[model samples]
Target chain A: MTSLTLNAIVSQMAAIEQFTNNILKILEQDARTTPAQIAVMTGRTEQEVKDQIAALEQKGIIKRYKTVIDWAKAGRERTYAFIDVKVTPSRGVGFDDVAERIYKYPEVQSVYLVSGEYDLRVVVAGTSLKEVSFFVSEKLATIDNVQATITHFVLKRYKEDFEIFEDTSEDRRLSVAP
Target chain B: MKPISHIAKTVPASGIRKFFDIVSQMDDVISLGVGEPDFVTPWRIREACIYSLEKGYTNYTSNYGLLELRKHISTYLNERWGLHYNPENQILVTVGVSEGLDLAMRAILNPGEEVLIPEPSYVSYKPCVLFAGGVPVPLGTTPESGFKVTPEQIAAAVTPRTKALLISYPSNPTGATISREELQAIVDVAREHDLFIISDEIYDRLTYEGHHTAVPELNGAYERTILLNGFSKAYAMTGWRIAYAASTPDVIEAMMKIHQYTMLCAPIMSQMAAIEAIKNCGRECDEMAEEYNRRRRLIVAGLNNIGLDCTIPGGAFYAFPSIKKTGLTSEEFSERLLFEEKVAVVPGNAFGECGEGYIRCSYATGIDQIKIALERMERFVENLGVEGRLKAAGRE
Candidate 1:
């Protein structure tokens, strides 16, 4: 293809990418935004919005719509802890194998291969502190190539997943203004 | 008993006074009538005020307001829209845009002179003019032009006694924003008529569709324009009561003379907090505008779908929808909607008589609340249709 045509195609792709980014941002803010609503908000047709969202889902970029809940407020308490792990690299695979093994347990909520002294950070949840400690000492520490671990229990959560947990804000504005 | 001053007694109360009494007594009313933002003042700005109190900076500053706050306002205006106003003599911070409007009117108007204002505008414009001992001439703008007043209409309204033209773009009831080119045409008419332009741009930052054109930025407008703006709508600082007016030195002096003698100055804490707002809260302002835009689209679309025949408002949070098809006056429609559906919207006539046959629905509430309001409105319209048919049958 000529360079001029290639440039045109590249710019067109960039525009589409920008449009997709905008749609993703809206959905991230409120997943319940329907195709028709998104269409009006983004100045696109409903069919076009539906098609883009479907494509995003197929690409795994649009993940599951999960609720951010305050379990303690809802009368369900779970002990949550963040575990820092140091691992000996297995030459080629390094910390990837150890991180995978640690994350495979059902109690592990999430695992990240992080920098600093610890090679991995693992988040775990259980019904009690003892239950969570047992998961870390018995299950996580036993993983291959794991050298040492440090665990910190979360006492209180002020905010989580971009939502303030203890929201006391009210609509104190006047009912009507000039 | 001796009567009160004639002007003070005769100046009309807000048209929403009756609705306020009823709405205050009712429970579970989802109100879309509020003109201010639903957001709390950003905590950082509030904290700045607390810090000022702790440091004992509570005494009144200059009559023109704090020099620091004025400098920041000057810099902010220049940076945002390239409009220049010297902080020392050209900017006078007032108690709110409310005070700024009063001061602008009092400073500029002579007794019996006329101020031509577009109809269906903010509630205070006419009252302020009257208090300034001026006649307010209303130039009606229809929904066919998206509630925007044309230069031709303005020219026609201009008379020898027309001393000033007052306008608020991204207006209160209709949410109409003027494009820069369109505004220039209006400015041209003002210049041709040699009329002072009092531009109340309190809703400038809340503009959704396009960038707001500061009136002073227009060619030859700076020398003739009295620009009024405030921190209320944009920074969620309505309660703070901090706003400013920028104009020529002579005009500012005139306004400051009135302000110093009557109002003295805006509160020190509000001025301090306003400085922090201008310095650090641009991002928060943008985020609020984006959210308003999203809600604006949803509410406008929902209003149209529910048979309200609303034009898309370009700025601010209001959606002015026509209720003519329902065979009810604006007041009747608003009253019935509030009583039956538990949804509160301002009757359009509250803004002006030209606003009759329409209702202003504010989309400043939550998305869920908007969705519920739309459903209620839809149900109400369907019931009205059935009731209309029944009434016709009874007549036959």
Candidate 2:
């Protein structure tokens, strides 16, 4: 392609990135922000906002809209642990195959192939400590190429999913201030 | 015992004082009263403060605040809006914009000198001027004028005794902001009159419409304008109490003289946090402004839908809606709304005389709370009888 065409493509890409970021940033903060409201806030037409969102959804860039719930506040208890796993890679597959196999279990909330001492970092959730330990020994240890597992159970969650779990900080500002 | 100083006795308590007393006693009140952000200071900025404490930085630096923080603020102002101030002598890190305003007033005003103030504005502007022994001449702004004081009004309000003109864009009570051209005209008037300019831009970052015009950036304004801005509204650091004033070195020195005698220095932890905020929290600040913009749309539309005539505020986090159609005074409307619907909105009269027929509702709270408040306000407005509703419709 000509330099002129490349420059035009680059500028267009930047514009598209900015446009999507404006809409996505708002939705990321509050998923329920309407297109009409987004239009007014972003200086775009409501129809345009709607179309852009639809296109994003179709492209699979925009996924689920979820609520960050504090389950403990709802009188329920869930024990979670971050397990570091040492994996033996198979020929030509590396950690991907083992990670895929480990993530297939229902208890695993998230699986990340991280660097450093651990080959894989898995977040597992269970109703109790014993349940998680049982899964770590029986289900996870039983898998092939799973060399060893080190589990660190979350003690008290102060925050999760960018939401503070137990925020009792009252509004300390004056009721009426300039 | 000495009758408390004549100035202190004469200056009336804040107009919102009555509501403050009453609101404090109420339970489960959905308040849109206070003009502060709902978000806590970003964790990174707060962590910076913690780190400062951990590093044992409890001692005061210079009366002008930490040099590193001042340099960061200087760079931020210049990079953000082309406003430059020397970090050494041209900036004073204040406790908040509140202190900045007070210092600006005291530093510039001579006894009995007049300061032109646009109303309804930030409540502290008039009192600050008065406390500094400057006579405050309020330039009334109306809904027809979009709650903006025109250059013509500022010119008319100016007298021979006028020492300075105080202006705040993206103003509290009304989210009104002045355009660059308009501000230039106001600055021109100030120049023509040989008056100083004190520009309180605490709500500068919260401006929703056009870009904020830093007064000092305008031609002929840099020398005379005392530019006040802070991290309170934008960075959600109100409790942290970090703000600054930028101006000429001479004026800063004079302000520093008073500050040294009284405040000495702003808290070191807050200064450290402010340094972090200015350097690294730009994205967090922008995101908060975006959130405020979304909430601004909701509350403005909600107020209009409830039969209140609300002008679209161009900036800040407030929605100043006319409650005149309800056939009640500003105080009466606010009191009734609070008692009847458990929604707390400041009466416009609390801002100024021109604000008497309106009410100032802050949109800084959560979306769900705003929605609930709007519903309650709708019911309250409906219960005001057919005559009031008819008046509202007639105005429409």
Backbone clash count for every predicted candidate, in the order shown: 0, 0
The TM-score of the first chain in every model comes to 0.85, 0.84
lDDT of 2 by residue, B243-353 (tens): 999999999999999999999999999999998999999899888887788788778888998889888988989999999877899999999899999999999988888
Off by over 4 Å in 1: A1-22, A58-60, A73-75, A88-93, A115-117
Residue lDDT tens for model 1, B330-359: 999999999999999999998888999999
* Top model number, DockQ: 1
Chain B of candidate 1 vs. true chain B, TM: 0.99
Flag regions of model 2 displaced more than 4 Å: A1-49, A67-76, A92-94, A128-134, B386-396
Docking class of 2: medium
